[model samples]
Target: MPEAAPAPGAPPHPVAGQEPGGPRVLLPHLRGFAGRLIAVMVLSLVTVVGALAQPLVIRMVVDALADSEPIKGLVAALVALVLGVAAVNAVRDFWLQRVAEGAVRAVRTRLTAHLLRLPVAEYDLRRSGDLLSRVSADTTLLRNVLTTGVFDLVTGAVTVLGAAVVMALLDPLLLAAAGLGLGLGMLCSLIAARWIRPLSERAQARLGEMTSEVERAVSAARTIRAAGAEERESRAIADRARLAYEAGVRVARVRAAVSPLSMLGTQGAFLLVLGVGGARVASGAIGVGDLIAFVLYVFYLVSPLTQAVNAYVQVQTGLGAASRIGEILAIPAEDLHGRGPAPDRAVRTPANGAAAEGADGAPAAVEFDAVSFDYGAGPVLDEVSFTAPHGGVTAIVGPSGAGKSTLLALVERFYDPRSGTIRADGVDVTELSRSQLRSKLAYVEQEAPVLAGTIRDNLLLATPDATREELLAVLDTVNLRGLAERTSKGLDAEVGDAGVRLSGGERQRLALARALLTDAPILLLDEPTSQLDANNEAALRDAIAAVSRQRTLLVVAHRLSTVADADQILVLDSGRVVGQGRHHDLARENAAYHELAARQLLVT
Candidate 1:
């Protein structure tokens, strides 16, 4: 049974410190790309040095023209300086691009590895599209920060500092004017920073939301079309997109305001330098060549100021992306320890206070004791207890939402019991390693998710080492041999997404065959015969009986006919067991069981 719900207004389970919450958190991940980043920084410095040398060359050229002393030397020097700066700029851009790509690759690899390790429960609440967006879009933002943002920050600072120094050298009055304009620009940028950060965060979140909506629509395209809700879904998606657009516009507005204010400060500085330097030249306080160089220096200062502003903006976006990525990485990964081999004494035994164990000394029994669970609505199961013994068929019969599927999940340890312990064999399931537990059980879900691959690949997923002969034998057991033979490629035939290429019954049989190939000690099946016709259901029932002889089977049987011949039947109502015995005995002794049997007959 499912667990009890938390109290009203209680806070939800927090998954803090798992995701990249902002750019700050990405510093650790950036370590792998540090060497590349350093190279990029060095290249940017070279570019800045070249840019600074330009004005000095111009000043020399002007002085040479006035002095008429070896004018050829000044001309050659100016041409060489121009060519050097251009060459350095080109090389630096290439290096920056390389660094960005490398950083992006590293981020994607780490993020993917982290996400794959997260517990199944985290994935249950997350949308595939949102996760995909984090891996794809968020990483792209971080790449921009590495390449464009970092380069701009380095070069911009160098340019600004060089220009200020040159302006001061040329004339103190011109330097003061430029400094005042730079101060104002800095103030405006600081103010804009606060606004841009939050807006960027909002924009990234909205992008995830938009992606989720689109994914939802596409996954349920058939249902939407059947219900004539395409327009409604379209509107919902549009609404999310509009929210994203609004968030982007807010960030854009801040950027728009910041850029112009910085540019205005640069223009003001330029005008002041022109006025002050022109006066100094006219008074003979500075040479005309020096005044010309001072104006050019002001232009250099603007380059760094603009680069600084843009770098800050990229940092803002990167922080937003980091926050989203952090959310995913923060979720606790499925613990790998304590799930290894159980103790020797922990074999399947009731006296050990553990669940049922396998008959052949294999750890294949499943038991739930006083277990309860909920999913925020209410208690789905309360104090429910049962044991499905090994080498036999134990059928769980219940109405819809009676915690049947939840019980199966507990056996697989998909979700731990909230207040009670579940055990496989004599060991507490929590003590069993996840891989060890999973290795022993073959679970065939109701929908039977099939990857987009060849039929042989899907079957081999259960037991990769299974030979062609073994595969064909299992296929025959599920009565899918005819279907397999009919396909042009036999077992190699392509199964579309979720095995949509096959009919419902065929898909179920294929899933059964896959499970059979695993030859695991225990089989946890959810509605194995739900999609089968009369003939296929009978064939599947026979297959289940054959499989149960050597392996333990716990089946969630919706149709009473499916469990009528079971060795033991546990009838569940709400989250409690209403009856337990053979099907006929339960029908005679329990009114609910009798009613359920009648309802099954009526439906059939």
Candidate 2:
């Protein structure tokens, strides 16, 4: 049979708990704090020792009082032991909490780095809110695992064992009866915990889905309101919230079963110890002081035993979250260096090389040789070839879905062609690192999405070291100088999340200004004039003409007027380059170009 496909929304790589040896996902985070953990263990041992000594001290006081001896010194010793144990526990708990916080910090840092470095394809397959949930909610679960789960398991076990040993030595028969009650309770708790982990995993997954719904609603709030979809959006979010609640209730039900069983066992053990010890003491088989000490020892086991059972359940829950976190970390990041065998001619071509030549003997800025791409369903770009020459304007004009923006994407190396090669400065792009290729070109996306930050912050994204004069000049070039003039803060003015505070036209202009700030030899703009008015479009055209004098500009435009004076125009139709030449020639001779021009009344 053919191999099965992975579920939707699953990572490309397998996550922890999906395979053998997956539990080690949390090991790296804990490994660095081994020394601190040892210190906690040592302090816990001290607390156990102090606790064991208390029951014996109480027995001595009881014997002295029965013999009519002074008991003040025994009482004082008991009080001092209690105080010392409390102090040691305080120190141990604080240290553990600090270590837990550090571990969580390390996990968050690593997760953030990994998520940011993931390939664009990965982001396309996953939701942003789900990924954020992993970084926030999933990592928080680990703190309880470290502080309460692992620590309690160790310290609680030691305390329970010490008490059991002391009780057995005092009277073997009573000890046997006490063991039955405690063991049954722990067994019931262990069984209940078996069901909690899986339920917790489902709960976490449901919560992530709910988060995705909220993110979608908020980010598209304007559209939702415009379409009169507020009620529909609210219903969608409510459905996700209800599913998450159901999952949480399932986990809570299993957890609830454990507490009562644990309490019953501990209480049963106490009653058994009382009845049997009373008989032994009256018959003179055991002394009154010894019976009292044995009873005290059983009481000592209560707290730790309860802690141990609860910790076991918590450990299971943490494991569930860990599995989700490990999935993202397991996927290999986009290779910074080129993948596959290195190119035979990895070095740059000389200016005289034919491959480097373009119009007027100048080197080409970007070249596509029979390049093609697909989005897994069908090809987006066929065997297409084009050249964006140095110091020239190469405008890509086509109907919607004709792969105009894709051509620019190929130049920036965002997605590699399934066949053929793309070259920048005569070196194949696959031969150079992504950072190296991207450094040579600046890109403004089609939507021109702006981040939530000040105007200065968004502008500095392209060129952090750009001076104040350079910023002002670029803003003026794109006709966005009015934005700074209107606000008293100038560049310090805030652009709300996704640039909500600015008009669509202003956001487009700001994006262009930011791209212009870069000193890259090539600029890629996808529909930069899509949102601009007639006046703004004319101003932007002038700015593009000025920039093209020194750097190559590859613009994807639907407005025929924008590219009317281009040095070269490539008309794409159904992923194929149907026409290429000066705009006037294509408008008169090319069928696809002529039809598009006629529709816009530009063929006259």
Candidate 3:
């Protein structure tokens, strides 16, 4: 009964001032890292400046040789310049990479935390594979953009600017030719980047598809194998993988042409500078050393220009992935992360259409008043009304999809009813933060999901502070004392993925034990004995009966006999509750109750 997530193929929620698909939302994350980037920039400045000064030093050495002005001194100066550039660059590389990685880590951590905290409905709409892809691959784009892309752009821009200034000072005509060459390279890079951007986006999306397929197959491996679908699934996954491969190839195809195109421009500039400057040198318009220095500066311009073009290409690719990441950030988290005061320990009487309290002093634990809801498309529950008093057991019996599970889910506030209200202790549940309300109840889902961990880890998930003695006591309540003793590691024994290592009965019992450890005032159990054999079922009936004595219990009971003595029995069919009374009374009078009892061979 978790709220339905957005449709799997639905477009991401839209952002203001942007087209349907966008990625420039990284400004906030970048703003936080500005200070670190400033430090990197200072070091980068020194390295680039040192590198730019090299051509000037060579110019001096060339002139000194022509004038016989002690070439040794100039050579030593050049060597010192090289060492300085190397040292600054090394330091710059370290801090830049570290800061970039730290920024990526920050984004990943925040995005993942936000994802998990999103409302259950959001999760239902989104596929786990796409979510995983955002966390793993999409965030990686930030690293590339921040580190490699930024690094190249920074150095390339500085070197180009520095080279331009020196070449212009040496000869204005040579500078003009170099500019013409760089302009052409920039044009080619822009075209290639434009082509690669869309392809990169397609490739990243395909990668997400591949991830989702693998996850779907792995999680349902047993079902797929039972259905003899190994070949089918393999082909499906292969198809996705092939699509991703083709997208990557398309991106590579565009990217492959970028470097060469950029190189062509640089080479053209080199020839133009050589021809034009050579003419000037012969016409005695410039010194031989000056012409040589101008050519060296042009060479410096070429490398930086080529680097800038390649870095631009990388930026475009990163933006493609970033668009996907931005889409996730855009989806709203329905306040699950909000903080509210702890759920009131002493339950209050139902207020605001809540179930009125009975003669007992105990407060109403759950009250549903004409609650109507749907997964998304149609009404699953229509005008469903019920009340489970503050304490004692209330059992819900219904045919499959009678919305029995949905009722419990609404009471738990997994999804707010589309119409009507639910109250916990007279206070509207919607008024309380999700965490606050959930903290007061312990739940055992129908499937009784068990995480992959030791028995202790699974139990401690409910009550982390519970001591060893307390843990054993709860395990005893669920008839798991023997399980605890039989396993090689007792409470520490491993429960494989989805508790596959444990028997079905053991998993269910362990889940019940974990819930018991919560010590919450209210307990919601769905089909608690569905997986149990006769012996375990009978044993669990006793356990449930005993546990009910101390807490408010709402159970979706599949077997009518199990709830024959429930304080209240709610019989449901198609959505509405058909009857409510003692199980024996319902068995005697309610048509639906009698039919269900007859089907399950239960006589109350």
TM-score to true structure, per model: 0.90, 0.93, 0.92
What's the ranking of the predictions by TM-score, best on top? Answer: 2, 3, 1
What is the number of residue pairs that collide in model 1?
23
Candidate 2 lDDT over 401-437, as tens digits, reads 8888777776765556677667888778877898888
Best candidate, lDDT-wise?
2
Q: After superposition, how far is residue 193 of candidate 2 from its true place, in Å?
A: 0.6
lDDT of each: 0.78, 0.85, 0.80
**Model 3 TM:** 0.92
Candidate 1 vs candidate 2: the lDDT winner is: 2
All candidates: CA RMSD (Å): 3.9, 4.1, 3.9
Model 3 misplacement above 4 A:
1-12, 15-35, 337-355
Query: Which regions of candidate 1 fall more than 4 Å away from where they truly are?
Result: 1-20, 338-364, 482-487, 602-604
Give the distance in Å from residue 489's predicted Cα in candidate 2 to where it truly belongs.
Answer: 1.7
